[model samples]
Target: MVVLNAVIEAAGLEKTYPARDRGGTPFRAVAGIGLRVERGEAFGFLGPNGAGKSSTMRMLGGVSAPTAGTLRILGLDPAAHGRRVRARLGVVPQDDSLDVHLTVRENLLVYGRYFGLSRKAVRERAGELLEFARLTEKADERVEHLSGGMRRRLTIARALINDPEILLLDEPTTGLDPQARHVLWDRLFRLKQDGVTLILTTHYMDEAEQLCDRLVIMDKGLIADEGSPRELIERHITREVLELRFPPGEHEQVAVKLGRDGLPEPERLEVLPDRLLWYAEDGETALARATAAGVQPITALVRRATLEDVFLRLTGRSLTD
Candidate 1:
């Protein structure tokens, strides 16, 4: 049974794929994991490639069956009642699977018909969705002629044809220009305000930080951690980070030098190829202390800790595919 007020629930979810080669072990895409998403809140699965995010999303959307687990969408078992569950869920896949031959309005209308709506009803909803997607003026334009952002919006509009209670977005803003991304974000934000539950999967740290009320960090088919963006940062990282860039190929050496040279022991020190991140409550003070210890770098910067730091701390890797 679904938990009270939970739109989606999973326990020990697992998905495995047959190996390409004969006599090889099966590939386990999703390890045992559990999560619950309540109504009207935006939840996210944040991870890089091969992190099982897409596999988990496919199961949640009823597109794939879990190998071993209990899964529910809207209080119904997806495996037992896929049609019923899917009817109330909108899916915006990573690819905008819009029909290039169809006009923008036609796309929505056709998709609505698939849900068994009356022709008249579908047309009316299509018009409203076109406006919601900011594509009303382009309603008559064929999708092939529209810009990338417009096509993405049309895809979203089509998914809403059934008035689903939950919407699943997979990398919603990938490949869009910044301006287009912001416009799409505004539309999604409005949906949140209107009490639509959102489940999204993305590798973009900034996107997760901006949109997710709570998120899970997944890696290697397992979840590393879960929490609200700010909570994760506060829990796993310091308040501020001082980035020090040393000479070429010296970042590793500087990581050791900073601590030994009287730099106030930071909460943590992360050494990357490009820079050394000194995690501390007081970034400026750390910088001053480092300077006093006679350490000089090519460049220095101080910035607030973020979700990326939390992911890095948990998974020991960047959130890039």
Candidate 2:
């Protein structure tokens, strides 16, 4: 195994796509971002759609080349040694591309064979991966008959056929139900516990908070902030958030009224279409003050600050936006 402090390193990485029309301006997807992800660390990329997270992942996975700057995977330049670099990396793309005609176990066996493993070795590894993915009971079923979560787990199992040092997952649980998402999260958590370096891009705030040891928030192809979940919240957001939902089209008016010293002013006030987020160290106190000042809302909620708040503050948009 290759041993390195930083399993993945990039300096001023960038990716640009040429415009389709003859006279149109080109679009730069990844705008010169730099990052260092260490071995055995679960690092994440958080961003909305078109924020270049996928583009960055493609470059890091050695599937796409950077338009400019340097990137080193396992201390080897991906541009120069794409094959060797990819051999040690496991990639789970945003969409599952399993061969539906194959049985669940067949999928793994086929992929393991592609890596040139002997028939006996591939069979053994496939058995272990099926259990790890909780698909042992369904091993004989064709992938076309598996549920969404089952197929997702099978995809992950397929990626592990070679026992890669680093696993890259792009939007791992975007379409799953709550229970399915948690089950997948458990599987991912186990991989991290086994000391596999995990690099993932996720739009789910809670998913990022649960899986990422450290993460960068990207917007418009740039890194807005980078830190642990707790650190980012403490740095860019208050300790608590008071969500006040007023009547339709009245939230802005309520925010204006609250800002005129009608209550204990929050550290920051964000006016959204359906609600007003009052950021404060003590949300209960702020809520009390709002009540005393007769700032009645259709509904009110005071909750501890979360990674979603930090993402919203940084990108000025929801995670799915």
Candidate 3:
């Protein structure tokens, strides 16, 4: 690992919440996970709902202490120095926990005071953050009067009140519209360019591809894989994948016949209810050979392999699944 002043480091980090029922085993939200994030890198935890992404993020945010293992953020132990750690870290939660009664700028000013900023200082920072979130026009509007996207942006701007060194985002774009998500992405890109270390959790493959410098894919409370999006895709799958769709019932039958022919057999073949994915170094070659053998697909498409394919290959389930 090319360590450029590691800002976040963990060894066997774990978290467990109390069981809901009496005598039941405690719920293990985050199983042992080891990670290292260098300064100024946009790191991410990519996973589906209930895959321990939130639990792990909570631990990193210093709001919840880990049950076991070790963690260090900015060279300080989060479990021990949570207050100091939080002072230098921004957090945009999955939910927009804005005070409905407060104006866009008032909310930020209030949060900034938690870090002990003077009223005048808080006001100044709130002004800058309002501009950053593109909420200058709505600065005096009550949060309840703002649109969903505007509220989300305000939440992010509020988290920056302390001028934190690192930012933690949990499913930042979960409910936003496409335009809102893109807008958030652009803001996050600027933060990355400004040398602020960021850690975010997301189930969106494209989001990870666009924003993360490095990431870990979590599943069932465990680290399934870790790498840059392209690195993970290349490591776990072929360069190209051919998607062949037929009538619902014919997938298994054709899949059997395709492999039986031994005509440049697919490097990997995935049989799905509606389609068959053929992995190959060259998708065109695979498609032509299949066509020559009278294995006609109702519809065929060839595309580059993606992180989504890597997830499916690793967990036997896609993000939606």
Q: What are the lDDT scores of the predictions, listed in order?
A: 0.90, 0.91, 0.91
* Model 1: CA > 4 A from native: 1-4, 260-266
lDDT of 1 by residue, 1-321 (tens): 534499998999999999889999999999999999999989999998889999999999998999998998999999899998989999999999988998999888888988999999999999899999999999999999999998888888888899999999999999999999999989999999888999999888889988999999999889898899999998889999999988889887777777745545447788877788899999998899779878898899999998888888898887762
RMSD (Å) per prediction: 2.4, 2.3, 1.8
Name the top lDDT candidate: 2
The C-alpha TM-scores of every prediction are: 0.96, 0.95, 0.96
Q: Candidate 3, overall lDDT?
A: 0.91
**Candidate 1 lDDT score at position 30:** 97
Cα-based lDDT at residue 119, candidate 2? 98
What's model 2's overall lDDT?
A: 0.91
Candidate 2 clashes between residue pairs 3 or more apart in a chain or in different chains = none
Instruction: Residues 87-146, candidate 3: write the lDDT tens digits.
Output: 999999999899999999889988998999999999999989999999999999899999
Which is the better candidate, 2 or 3, if ranked by lDDT?
2
For model 3 the local lDDT of residue 211 reads 94
Report the lDDT of model 1 for residue 152.
Answer: 86
